[model samples]
Target: MGKQMFSKPPIQKSHELLLPTTKESCWILVFLLAFGVSSIHGDDGKIDFRYHHYLDLSRVLNDTAASCHEISRVYSVGKSVEGRDLWVIEFSDNPGVHEPGEPEFRYVGNMHGNEAVGREILVYLVQYLCSGYQAGDARIRRLIDQTRIHIMPSMNPDGFERAATLGPDSPRTSTSWGSYGRLNSERIDLNRNFPDMLPVWLLQEESQRRNHHVEIPEWYWDTLVAPETLSVILWSLSQPFVLAGSLHGGSVVVSYPFDSCGLRKVMRSYSEAPDDALFRKLAKVYVDGHRKMGKCGQVEPCNARNFTCKGGMTNGAEWYCVPGGMQDFSYLVTNCLEMTFELSCDKYPGEDELQTYWEDNKEALLSYMEAVHTGIKGFVRDGSGKGVANATISVEGVDHDVTTGELNIFDIKTYFLIPQRLTETTGDCSFRGLTG
Candidate 1:
């Protein structure tokens, strides 16, 4: 029993203190307490925490699948200028929705890079749905069961990386105009660069003519090719029964069709026909959702019953005639119902206030989701059989509305469509829905 090293504490010290007299003695007490707690608590594991960021988000998505074994897939639509993969994570009980002929509900975020909360919200939404489903939450389960959600967390990864690396304090007035951190190398506003080019240009030119000045940035004319912008347009065009929205930041608002020149006459001039009932319904959905968010001040009445038209830049199917853009292209080529959602107030709200924004907008966001679930859409055509230009279209059930532009149509329901213009090339058009 050589030295019986460390076999016991000093007898004299133990007697003096009436307690553990050595470091080894203290270890035993700590271990015992830990074991006792474990025994009592049965070792509940750590709670998973989620945050915004592509890699971290992907890991969370992977962890979620491993933990719950739910149905989900991370698919790439195209490559960014930096060669980063632009991903769309699909979540649904039925992954089969990706199969040919199935409908899709698209929710995209971070198109401008500076507005990153949508990425987090989208990721959180997935986690919420999956966790809720596992926990037997009926509403969550039903939504997943009925709808296929396609979430593109960061549409402009190149720009997003630039923004993240430069930090938040970087001046917005920096001379570097075409960096991936701000806009594409071409410097075109991705939000304004959809395929509906003609209507957009017309509106832009009209605005300049009215003001008797040219304020359009030089960069707008410099970059003609937008890969990131093109990919989203192409992806939307490929989908069926698609009700899609592009999420942006700055003034909190929900804007629908006729984004191009925002005049009633401009809209009417472009749309071969008019569809008042449909326009009113779609506007109502947006109006109702905005009211719930405490954003009553920003919700403007659209060009429908008791609604008034407010002029703004034309984008989407209602304003432009183009070959690209998520909404315009989707409406022109795929016949999907699409809209753009501006989330959060200007200057990007602080992280602490993000929850409030979410709470206010969640119902409105879900209304869009609900619209997709119900498969509600409408179409407008001109007299010439070519899809009409600047026509107002709406969905009766959800109160969603959009104006259609040259060679484009509007989808009220899932935002999917067949290519057909109004029979009249230059005059008013007619539209009908399930109601009215």
Candidate 2:
């Protein structure tokens, strides 16, 4: 089949609020998007949902980018330990361009290379988004028109190759005790290699402890960091990502932030964040949309690993203390509300089951993408109507605040757009001095 041109979809009606501004200070005009979640259909049996090698995945992304040039494009964030590109395929009305007021969302899969289910599902999701938009699927059209969706199908290509070499049915790789090919080429657990805030928080006085938008610690450089971890960290800090999902396997549940706990070495402790309620809501969106995962806040059978989660959602720390996890890094170090989705109990499921897994997760994936637009998003501009740089925006009651400014980490400079006032739907917001 040849490429098809997709006509632009009409913009949906957005509720715009224009607050008065002064010449000396910048004002923020916040608007809310009409929240609508719907199932996406249009499985044309064209794009195959199979386990892809790094080269094959690259080609798939490239081909999709060419076919869906109007709404999708491919780019690489960085390389893995073994020099594999950490490619990201983005879908939007205007591909590769950042549109003001549009929230950016991302899904990162195969962080643990052995957990191949998410990587394959994400690849399927890429094809679905592109095909759905081209096929005039209304829900998908809305998603592409309103939000920038970035999907990195594989974050640990080196480990993935290792796992694929062992084959899915290999007893050594399939065993619960053995975590073959789970680490990157450097043999470091990427999830646990990020700068841990638990250590920093414990050392700080209660009054001095910073929870939200936490900075990377200086001593973190003294330790060995995985290339994949650094790449993701730098990539995240460089953007104004509003929402994200880290896909994993070996469990079937949705878990939200504070993956690490203040209580040292605690196996089961609830380390809740200030935006705990909002995080729970975000996590529940996926769970409720999932076909098997029952409604959030209610006990449901997962049917895998004999696991049952109340509402198929859990607080990350309560599930298990994972120090330096990506979920926590996203919430604390960047303007991204991240959740970890344990998509399947089988980490390296057979490729033949990819389509079934995709069918089970398609709605949940799309619904979560739609949820990004459910929050307040707008622009911080000066009296001249130009975006004000280095503006710190905060809600009256929310403990966390987002900044619009330049951040220099590991000597790499990152400039971020003004993030959404991620707080209550109805609340007063305050902005700090314009440093632009």
Candidate 3:
């Protein structure tokens, strides 16, 4: 039970058929009304301000590393668009080294500068884990000992600093001009800037077979490669991450992939991921922790317009289609299962509200991190008990099968760093394709 830090660096699916009808669609309509009202409706400036500016956050993280030197280290993954170093705080028995049979977990916060709730919680999370370990908490000791945990408290520093409604160059927010502050500095919505998952041709120059299609008027996206998004993509690629989540705001729900609805459609649509059952359990951990997230009634959403995210979860696109989102990109291109957590109803909660928000979410955060260990993992061995190298590992209900790597341990795309957890009750006897 201990803690340390280095320089600076940075770092779901479920199958269900609950189609939206005209009646259920009312939630969407009421939500739009509530959202619009919330935009204009301020908290009477009664809220205080206590969030960290970019430099202050750096100092805090650096201090944490200096204190927990043994169990922690600080390093820089990459820089932001405006050249601010994207610092990462690592907590593990051994930081920066890949351990066999160990799963890597990551939490990214404040992808949207204005949506500051996530960034704040992540800051607390680092301290929470560090302090717990120092206090000799067994849970903290086991988590850091068994898994690699990476936390990026602020992914969009520039956007947070911008203090504007939208990206300066964005036409979408040209007239609205309030405090949307949702896009990155270049004015592109980072959430909507990742490579789209819908099967369609990019610019004619890019073919179907190419791995990265980054050359669009905006690279098949409306915005070019904002440095923040690029930094995250590279960091995830460099690790053997199995489970990840990003913190967001403006809603109080946990959204799982695919963020897009295959193609562009205005209304709600359905797209089930390969591992729908697995994803559901992962989300339920958080929703169940925060019973309010799964509840709808007095003061909360009983219908579409006012905090109406039923059961506290929904498919990203089914709520509404958003192409090129980060959640979908993580699953389609990497060995990670990432979910976007809309932590609070307010994109940026006031200073006094920060602690209360943390109280509500801290348990869910800790639980979700622990949930990574609940999934299935083991070597696929032979009759003589010899290791089986390069053996195919397939799950029947799931779309893709994984192939074993060097140790013949059915590692899947792990060599390439491709992704989850298996539970005893739910995971037992699952995946029919472990063949001869």
Global lDDT scores for all candidate models: 0.47, 0.71, 0.62
Ranking by lDDT: 2, 3, 1
Of candidate 2, the 10-residue stretch with the lowest lDDT total is 11-20
Off by over 4 Å in 1: 1-51, 65-69, 96-102, 170-180, 185-188, 197-223, 262-280, 290-294, 297-325, 375-436
Q: Specify the highest-TM-score model's number.
A: 2
Best by lDDT, which number?
A: 2
Report the CA-based lDDT of candidate 1 relative to the real structure: 0.47
RMSD of 2: 9.8
Model 3's TM-score against the true structure: 0.73
Local accuracy of candidate 3 as per-residue lDDT tens digits, 1-436:
0111212222200101111011110000000000000011111121222577888889878888877877888888877767887878999988867665667799998777777888888888787777777777777788889878999988878777764333323223433223355666567677876667554322321453432212112333333667777667667555656789999876788888777877446457766776565666677777766636777663355346444446788888778887878877767655477898888766655577887877677778877887766535555344444444434444444553343334223433222122242322221112322111
Residue 386 local lDDT, model 3: 48
Q: Which is better, 2 or 3, measured by TM-score?
A: 2
Point out the worst 10-residue segment of candidate 1 by lDDT. Answer: 25-34
Tens-place lDDT per residue, model 1, 259-351, is: 443334343234321222333344345435543322333544322311222322222334333233444434333335566665554323445
TM-score against truth, every candidate: 0.59, 0.82, 0.73
In candidate 3, stretches whose alpha carbon ends up further than 4 angstroms from where it belongs are 1-49, 164-180, 200-223, 264-266, 302-309, 379-392, 403-436
